[model samples]
Target chain A: MKRLSRLALAAALMLALAVPVSAQVSDGVVKIGVLNDMSGVYSDLCGPGSVEAVKMAVEDFGGKVLGKPIEVVSADHQNKADIGANVANKWIDVDKVDVIVDLPNTAVCLAVQKICQDKNRINLISTGASVILTNKNCSPTGFHWTYDNYALGKGTGTAMVKEGGDTWFFLTADYAFGHDLEKSTAEAVTKSGGTVKGSVRHPFPCNDFSSFLLQAQASKAKVIGLANAGGDTINAVKQAAEFGIVQAGQRLAGLLVFISDIHSLGLKTAQGLVVTTGFYWDQNDETRAWSKKWSARMNGRMPTMAQAGCYSATMHYLKAVQAAGSDEAKAVAKKMREIPVNDFFAKNGKVREDGRMVHDMLLAQVKKPEDSKYAWDYYKILRVIPGDEAYKPISETECPYLLEKK
Target chain B: MFELIGIPPQALFGQMLLGLINGAFYAVLSLGLALIFGLLNVINFTHGAQYMLGAYVAWLLLNFLGINYWLALVLAPVVVGAFGILLERLMLRKLYHLDHLYGLLLTFGLALIIEGVFRNLYGISGQSYPVPPVLTGGYNLGFMFLPLYRGWVVFVSLVVCLGTWLVIEKTKLGSYLRAGTENPTLVQAFGINVPRMITLTYGFGVGLAALAGVLAAPIYQVKPTMGADMIIVVFAVVVIGGMGSIMGSVVTGFMLGLLEGLTKVFYPEASNTVIFVVMAVVLLIKPAGLFGKAS
Candidate 1:
């Protein structure tokens, strides 16, 4: 009877060992959720293109991790912070998503980041511009992958001020996004020995820029810096032409612009305009190759810098999952910070302990009519702002994690 | 010291003139919205889309038909207004008895459809419309330069607003319309076609928005989203002005625009929110609005 009991115990132990080995061979699928402004203003940059970018990364990585298929799902957060947070929570709990990607709006990203941290999920933020994500409210579980307001302001404003566009006037959009852009750009202007003659804050989606344009004209500033993006930027540029602000020797600086905005303004109106960004479509052979594939998927719309960031983050996340040998969120996240992220967008880029994937930024100028050779040709490379030079100093950031470590 | 704190007369006068120009657009758009809401009780959320259609129609006229701005300014509204009339007769006329929110929803859907189609075709870029040669250049007013086109906007809008007011208030047709709004069944008994009047009123409101759009084309780019943003602010304007009286909407629009301009001069940070702030204050003091009727 004792011998029979021992045989049964041996059989049970063997069964338990077999079950774990089989589970290790095929555990569970890695689900990643991409939340963004799918149907709103930032749609062109990080909307459908972001989805496509993630799919490309999955495909390029062979679409499997830990012997399980990879799955991607996306939603339009509609640029609302509350909606974004809710979506993030549901994606983590209900869908069992391991990562959330491409949150565009700063406020929405901040809210969604908190949710991801609470749920112990990874968040790869690509489109938001607020410095606060990495400054006051940085999270270990969230990675700020692309450019921010301070980087854009420092790269564009300081460069323009040094280039002899001394006096500045601002036509700012009235929103958190606009306010941050204006504040950072204004700081750069002052630091570079440029004087901000005056500024006018217009309501978002304002149609008639006549009053604002007239105020800018009256300021007599040499450069009329547009601290607005998307439709606001397009309107300000068009009206500046109508009001002849450019003819009066006032240069226009688009602090944050997309390829779509440049295409809308066309070469005639957008000529000689300087802007700063972390990516451009026609930057190099690798960029062109990636853009060519992305264009085929995005209905011929060229990939913006934000779109490129989406690709980099997704590729890095999948690689980390593979490295960790599991789809568990905490394990994958720890692997992410440890691994060096290398791609066409970045060379030897490392995801910092504080969850910032540092990369190079570019300063580009809109080409003149004569410089254009095709339909969507917009910008010419001005200078390659190095990765270290493009972003704000990490020492300057007031993030609690960074402070605690120090 | 006086020159430092107090705006120079030239600058202040120039800004006020600019304010008046902006007010012209506000007045025209608000008047159209009020007219539609007062009679048909439809929020016409697609007002901006219709305005965009007017600009695009003008652009198409100039691009394909070789029509000038002068011709487009006259014919574009008519074309857009006809589109509005058809929309009213076919779709909007069916929703009069349903919840008012449905009308808002339907119009909002129509707006999405129009904007999406435009964005798909033309993309989200701005298309330039040249100023008519006649209105090109600026006139020096000793204090600042006034573009001729801006002055034209203010003058033309004033004429249109007052003309609309006169038509709705002083004429026999206007009286019949007012009677129709009060009791459409009774007006129908008097041998007047109330439904036709309602349809025409919607068409006229759409036409007014289109006209304002045409006026804005040269000053602003003819873009898909031109109207989407403007219409929201106009809604706020409509809410604050209290849709109770036509003239009240006009006065309130101009006053708020001037207030916004003043904020730009002094506290630029609050410029965008000043109109909303005023609306809140007015709502607190009188929930019916500054000029709105009690619901």
Candidate 2:
């Protein structure tokens, strides 16, 4: 009886140690949670479209990662930081979500980033624009995928300054992201030899930009840099046209513009507006073919950069998981940095130590009404900014990882 | 020619004119609220939603029917006001005899449902409405270039406000309407159809909101939340102006717009909250409001 009991105990211990090799995923199912502005100003840019993109990636990756079934779940943050954090907490702790993606609003993105880091979950940011995500609050498991404020500001500012829009007045939104965008754009403007005339601050989600636009017109700057996004940018641009700010010879630079915005503003009002973008659907065969497929599912609405980023990021992360042979957050994150990202959205993209995925961006001018030949044809690509030029240099990164290394 | 605190005179005047233009919107929106509250006493929380519907109707007319802006300006109000009539007849009428909270709750829920339906139909980035050719150019005021559309907005607002004020303050029908709302049974005994007057009054007020929406379509993105954003500020203006006073809402609306505009220039950060500050101050000093008659 003593010999038989000892033999059973030894067999049970061996089985426990051997189980990990077969089941690398902790929860047996790899869950991905997409949290974004599902019903706010940015809904069109990164809301349900983002969810579909991630699901598409999962399906394209065979609906499984590391021999475990992959599941996609999404929720509306409603543009509130607290709600985003609550959802992120529940997703990570309760649902055992392996990764979170597509956080758009700056406050919400930053909040979720902190929560994900604490919970040891991967945070893949495809939409939020603040440079602080990579600089001040970089996490080992967090990846800033699509674009940042610095990328947008520098790309558009340098292009505009070269077009003889050397003097600029800014219509800035009053918020963390807005101020960051203004600062980044201002730095870029100065770096590129453009002198900022002055600036006016408007409330976020503002409907009437008449007061602010009047100030901009009075400044007599050669160019007006609208350092705002979504609805605020749309209204400012629309009102600027009404005030004849464009016709009077002053150019307007939409610092952060989405194809969705151009669609809303139409060609007549949005024409000739200089913009910087990470992805344009109709860029080339790969992008056009991919976007055509995606748009077919989206009721023919082309994928915005953030939505496309969601697809690309999800695909890359899945590939990394497949390579690492695990869904563990740290292992997958490490594997993600090791493998180079080559997708339709990002070409030869490399994830730096600061967690910024350096990728090529496009500088384009909105096409004239007559220049637009077909539906959803908006941009006339001015130039391609190589990945290094679009994103911030590693030398300038204040990410704690590099600082601790120093 | 003197500047107010570091802002140049040109900037100040430009801001004032711009503020007045915004004030035109506030005045029109609050005026509608005042008309409804004065007679119907329904506290139409859906005023903002109706205003949004007005813009959508105008957009639909232009897009689907190939209608021009001028005809839409006339037709949208009628259509949206007709919608308002449906709300009153079907739902709002039952709650009219209840507490103010009941009516407020019903209208608030209706507003959300309306906004949600629109949000579902249109994905919320919003649609654009172009300025007509007639309203395209601007007069080069030395201090600022005033858009022809803006000038037209102010002009239309004044005409509408004045027309409503005249009908309510000077007409025999207006007196009958007022008396009917004051004492419905007495007014009924006097051989007047008081119920029909109240119903038409509610429609007229809602029509006014839709009219403002049409005027706003070109300047702002015609989105579902446009009315929602403006309604809170307009409510503050109505409260400050005296809830049921037509002239009170009109004057306070314009005044607050100018104040907000000035705030944008001097202290831009507080512009959105400055109106609420004024409202708070007014509430502290005189709970009845600046132009409110003691009930």
Candidate 3:
């Protein structure tokens, strides 16, 4: 009886040891969760299009790394922060998602950022526009990819001011993202010798921009800076055209313009509008090729900068995992900073200690209806703002990561 | 010369004009709601989706059938109204003997289904419908540049509201509708076909919303959710104007729109919430609404 008990104890010990070993190996399957605005106003900017972009990146990377398969899962947060947090929590605790990407709204992104930090997972923000994500809210495992408000303001505001749009009036969306965009664009406008006549704040997701447009027209400013994004920007611009704000010689400076907005507005109403972006699908041969593959999967709708950023960020994240030979969030994040992103979307893009991905931003104008040769040929590149010059300086940020590094 | 109450006269007047345009939408929509509620005693929640459908139908007509804006202005309502008639016959007609909430719940579910279908097909970014060539430009009204399309919207909406009022108040058909609202069974006892009148009334009310939708297509983009938010405010206007009266709904819609416009000029932040605020105040003072008969 004693000998039988000893054997049973040994079997139990072996099983206990084997459980962890099997768990470790099974965890090798990397899961990437994309939480974004799937059906809301920002859906067109980054929705199913973004999910398709991420899948294309995975397939392009041969669908496997470290002898383990990579999996992509997505959920619509419905543009609610609490819902987004719940989704992020489920992804982290239940699904063991290694990375989260393509968060669009600033409020949702911030909530997900906190959840990611608590779970110690990697988060790559591809579509969110808040600069605070890299400043006070920066996380060690969080990387702010694509464009931010500072970059947009520097690229579009400075250029517009230089092109004789000095006097400014703003029609801002009343929310965190809109407030941040307006604040940054106004700073840039003031820095470039432009005078801010007056500004009005309108509710987010609002349909009627007529009153706000009238208030802007009353300012009689040379430039009406649209410090909103996605649907709000589109609505404001269309209403401005209806009010003949453009014909009266008042320019509309879109602070955070996306390719999707231009597409929806069409070239006739959206012509002569100067905006900044990190990626234009028709920028070069490589981009065109990648965008073609992306468009094929996206129902022939060309990928927006946010969608392209998803592809670029996913590809880079995978490369970092391969380089580190591990899926641990900290190691993968450290490796992400060590490597330079040379993807088709961004060349020589580097993730900094403050979690800002520095990449070249392009200033482009909507092509006239007469200049069209193809369906998606919408932009005429006016200038290329260097990556280093476009973003905010590291010394100016209050990120704890930078302070700790010093 | 350009200033008014610390704001430019141009800005104030421009905002007022915008308010009037918005008021036109509210007036037409509430007028429909009141018309239906009078006889059916069921608040048609699907009214907004029907409005959105009107816009989409107009767009489809223009894009697929090469229908001009003028023709679509008449045809889209007819199409949407026919759908309304079908809905009344197949579904809404059965719930007349049940609780009023059943009809409300039924229409609410229908609204969700309609909105979801459109959202699934088109997504929510909204498609642009160009202003007709005749209404493309605007007149520099000295204080404000009045876009011809906007002016046309206000004018057409006023005519529609007045025409509806006249038809319901001054004609023989109007007497029948008013009588049907008071006692459907009594009217049916006289061989008036009250059920058919109820269905036609629902269709006409729905037709009014669709007409507003066609008018709004160029002003606001053709979006599935365009009428979703507008409908809520129109409901508030109905509540404030007393849902019992057609003329009351029309007047309250335009007046509230102008109030909201003035709010934007004076305090931009309160423009959105002002309508609800006024509704609360009106409800507290007169529970039955301004034009509603006391029970």
Candidate 4:
């Protein structure tokens, strides 16, 4: 009778060890919640498009992982951090979302990152350009999947400076994201032997930039770094052209411009503007194939890098879950960092210990109206910024995840 | 070589010119609001949406019909004005007997619905209207490189604001309109169709708003939310100028614009709020406003 009891115990232990992944999945399903600005200024770039990207990734990943069906849900944070935190809490506590992705606004991203960490759910940051996430407030379960402000600022700052734009004046939005971009770019400018003449902070979402533009024009800086995004960036760039700032011999460097911005400004105005991006849909054959499929889903609108990051991050997270055979946040995060990302959006990109996905960023210039050959052919790739140089160096990361690991 | 508070005279003057240009928008927009409030006694919260529609109509005319700017400048206001007439006839007419809050709420809802429809159809980035061929370049004014398109706005908007103000405060038609608002039942007994006059007045107020919209199309991005950004400030301008004070609205608009510009030169962070600050102070001290008649 004692021997029979021992044999039964051994059988139960072996069975529990064998399929731990399926057993550990909180519920019978793996849920991915896409939390972003669904109905605000960022809606076009990171809202519905991100949700679609994550769904596409799940479909492409065979609809199931570890015998559990993958489900995607989305909500709008309305560009408010408290609202974002509330959504993140409900998603993790009630909905059992294993990962949340595509946080666009900086404050929302910062708020949601802390929530996911406390709840042990992985947070995939696809947008939200602030560098503070990986610097001061990073988490073990958090991974910055796409580009950050530092990478964008450094690449553009270096490129512009090399092209004789050694003096820069920034027209910044008076907000955390804007200041982050300006500080990052300014650091890069000085590092590359350039000088920042001055900077002016304008109200966020300001429609009129003539006040700040005149100040920039007065400074006579060789380049004006627009450290603002969305409508703010569009207005500043438009007014800069109207004021003939470029014609008067100053260059305009849109440090963190998105393709949607170019699409709005059109080539006539956006032409010759230098910018930095993480992914371009027209870069190569693989990108073209993926973008064709993605853009078709987006009603012929090309996917922005933020949307592309959604797909790449979700796919990699699923793969991590599959490899590690558990939906446990730390285990999946570990596997994700262990695997090198080789996909349409990135080639052998790496997620560092500090939770940043270091990939080669593209430095491109807006093609003139006549130079554009096809629909959405907005950029002419001027250079490829290497991953090592584009991303924040590992030595500088203040992420507790890495600091504790070391 | 002269400087004011450490800024070169050139920069200060350049900023001042930009401020004046912004003020032109305020003046025209507030003039429309004043006209409506003075006559109809209805707070036209839809004024900003009307302005946005004006810009969109101009963009459509140029892009679809191949109509030029000068033609769109005339046609857009007329078209948007007719729409306003329909709005006044079908919707606003029924709400006249209700409290002021009802009209405000109704117009506010209408504004949201209009903005939502546009956004749903044309997603947010907004379209760009190029500078007209005639106004492609700019004039170097030593202090600033003033785009001819922008300069034309300053010149034309000022004339329109003054002209509208004159016609309202001077002409025979203006007298009847003012009389109709003062004692509508008595004016009806005088054989004038007060309802038709009120509807037309509301339409005209909306038209003026659209006129400013067309003027702004080239300078600003033609987006759904553009009107939303301007509406609150324009409303503040109306309040500060007194609800129905036409000339007061015009003069106060320009002065506030200049004040905002000066603030930008000295403390740019407070520029967006300067108008509101002035409005608050005026509300606290001179509730009747600078040009308003006290009740």
lDDT of 2 at A174: 89
- Stretches of model 4 off by over 4 angstroms after superposition: A1-22
Q: Which lDDT tens digits does candidate 4 get at residues B1-295?
A: 7777899999988888888889899999999999998888899999999999999999999999999899999999999999999999999989999998888998999999998888887788899999898998899999889888888998988898889878877998888888987889998998999999999989899999999999999989999999999999998888898889988888888888888888877887888898999999999999988788888
Q: What are the clashing pairs of model 2?
A: none
Tell me the whole-model lDDT of each prediction, alpha carbons only.
0.84, 0.91, 0.90, 0.91
The residue-by-residue lDDT of candidate 1 on A1-406, one tens digit each, is 9999999999999998887466542237788898998767777667888999889988888988777888999998999999998888888878888889999989899999988888788899999988888778888888999788888888899899889988999888888888899999999899899999978888776665766777787778888889888877887787777677787787989999887777766777778889998788787798889889989987788888788888899998888878877665677779998988778888777777677777777899999999888767788888888877777778787889779989
Cα lDDT tens digits for candidate 3, B83-118 = 999999999999999999999999999998998899
lDDT of 4 by residue, A279-379 (tens): 99999999999989988888899999999999999999999999988899999999999999999999989998888999999999999999899999999
lDDT of 1 at B77: 88
Q: For candidate 3, what's the RMSD?
A: 2.6
Native-to-model Cα distance after best TM-score fit, residue A5 in candidate 4, in Å: 21
TM-score of 1: 0.87
lDDT, residue A4, candidate 1: 96
> Which is superior by DockQ, 1 or 2?
2
A154-232: candidate 2 lDDT, tens digit per residue: 9999888888989989989988888899899999999999899999888887988888887887788998999999999
DockQ ranking from best candidate downward = 2, 3, 4, 1
- Among all windows of 10 consecutive residues in model 3 chain A, the one with the lowest summed lDDT is A19-28
Please name the candidate that would achieve the greatest TM-score relative to the true structure.
2
Flag the better candidate by TM-score, 1 or 4: 4
Query: Compared with the true structure, what per-residue lDDT tens digits does model 3 show for residues A303-329?
Result: 999999999999999999899877778
What is the model-wide C-alpha lDDT for candidate 4?
0.91
How far is A101's C-alpha from truth in model 4 (Å)? 0.8
